[model samples]
Target: MIYNEISKVIDNKEIAENIFEAHLSSDNLSKIAKPGQFINILPSSSFDKTMRRPMSLSYQDSNSFKIIYKPIGDGTRIMRSWKEGDSADIIGPLGNAWEVSKNKEAILLGGGVGIAPILNLYNNIESTHPSHLFFGARKKEEHFIDHNPDKNIYISTDDGSAGIKGNLFEAMKSIFDINDFKDKSIYVCGPPMMMEAVRKFSVEHDIECHLALETIMACGIGICQGCTVEKCSDESSTDTYRNKYELVCMDGPIYKANEVKTCLL
Candidate 1:
């Protein structure tokens, strides 16, 4: 079920370089929210910004949920100024959750701020399952996860400042061959290029892959018809008047890699 509520801010602070983490109290939203689902939050109560900003859920418990984001524009910049006791008009638990495979090992890939959903997926699955995380960023300082010896985590940066010098694919290639991932399921959320590369690689190797897509959203619901992605199976569609496009906000943010075309924005 979807919810529209005025959630109260429990805590808000900058955790990394330009990245802010905020916790909002919402009992219903928190309980039903799943990995790869997101919330749409209005920066202010007034009509200065009509469109709400969509943010992926990074963590959640019984009474509150956490969102990690980078303030890249006016809406998010206003969100950065939000503090404790502030009320945010939000709609959420939108989009589908990741279809986690219980029998297979899991491989999670994330980049930059896209790590929000990936982290959420990991936190949900890592406890009882075997999971590996491959996280990438432009620079070493841009990464949110600190170096920890206990986690099955790998890091890569564009510059040679972090673990692997190249992209996430490079880091994955160094550790495992195609045969090593035969029994694994891959989940990815990141920039367009990164997701595209992973999609191609997954197809080439016949690996099972799922992607959490990111796009500009207006309504965060299907009413606006603003966030549509071309469906991969359009050739079989019977509807000729309308193109075979799915709304990202309602139908997905999570889709099987083979179910949609790659390089989704």
Candidate 2:
């Protein structure tokens, strides 16, 4: 179920270069927040920023949840000042979640701040399912590399500052043969270019792949119709959705790689 309420901050700290992780207390909300779902948070009660900021849920426990973000915008800039004991108006657990396959090994990819949701998925499924993570960033400092010692972790940076010093595909190719992905399900959350590349690679290999999209949202719910993306022409036209477009806030934040025309928009 969806919820709109005031949640208190439990902790907020800078985890990486410009990335900040905030823990919020929300018993019921946390209980239902899935790996790919997101929340819209009002950074402050003031009218300076009318629209709430949509953020992915990075982690969740029994009584609280976490959001990891970079304070690069006005709303998020205000969010940086928020401390423990502060209250935030939030609406969540929104959007569809990653449909993980129990039968196939999971290959996860995350780029930049998009790693938040991917990390959430990894935390939830790594214990029982075999999973691998390929994380990429522009520089060494921007990457979040801390993980369980036993977990399969791969790293890449555009500038060769860390790990493979290349893109995700480069990193993957170095350690994994094409056959290694034979029965694996790929899940990705990243910049449009990265997602598009992964989508093409997945299609070429005929592997099952899912993408968690990042787009500007006027409303976290489907009400505003502001987060629309062109649908693939081959997608079946439903009576209520025959317009050749899909609302990212409602229909997805998550979609099968082949289901959408392109993520480059």
Candidate 3:
């Protein structure tokens, strides 16, 4: 279920160089929010922008939720200037969420802003099962987000500024035995190129991989038909099956890696 509410910004500040973290207080919205779900926020500024921006749920407690974003454009720049008392109408908790089965180990792979959802996923699986995180960014400057280093979290920077001098998958290969991945459930959410690399690795290794895809959305309710992705029958299935377009908003922002054609688009 989705809740539309005018929620107050409890706190707002820059957590990193260009990234701003905003905490919102809402009674009804926070209760139903789950890991991997996102919220559509109505911009109070940016009059020219007609549609709400979809921001992933970065952190959530019992009474409030939070989102971490970069003010890269007109809408987000305006959002950055918003004060704590300001209110915005947000619709959430939207999209399908991530899940883990009993006794199954989890491997989280995130790149760039795709790291947003993993925080929630980690919190859920932390005490229940063993979980590991692999994060990647373009540079060390972009690695401003916080995570427990003690909790088996590894990082890779493109410039070798921080941990491994490669991508998240490369970081993974350097740390753990690739053969052990077959028994683990991998969750990935990142850019297209990065996700493609992860998808290829997962397929080749015959691992259980789930991916969170990001795309431009308008309605965010599947009515806009804006975020369509090609659906594949299985990892080994060929083009002989007729291509089908699935709406990311409704069908998923989260999907099994083998169930979709990640390399095509």
**Which candidate number would show the highest TM-score if scored against the true structure?**
1
| Alpha-carbon lDDT, every model | 0.86, 0.86, 0.81
lDDT of 2 at 219: 70
Question: Which candidate model has the greater TM-score, 1 or 3?
Answer: 1
Worst 10 residues of 3 by lDDT: 234-243
Q: For residues 116-172, could you state the per-residue lDDT of candidate 3 as single tens digits? A: 888678877788789888878888778864445687887888889887888887877
* Candidate 1: 10-residue stretch with minimal lDDT: 234-243
Q: What is the lDDT of residue 169 in candidate 2?
A: 65
The C-alpha RMSD in Å for every predicted model, in order, reads 1.6, 2.0, 2.8
The sequence of per-residue lDDT tens digits that candidate 1 reaches over residues 147-194 is: 442577988889969777888777777778889989998999888888
Q: Return the TM-score for each candidate structure.
A: 0.95, 0.93, 0.91
Candidate 1: how many backbone clashes?
0
Candidate 1: Cα lDDT at 143: 76
Off by over 4 Å in 1: 148-150, 234-243
In order of listing, the candidates' clash counts read 0, 0, 0
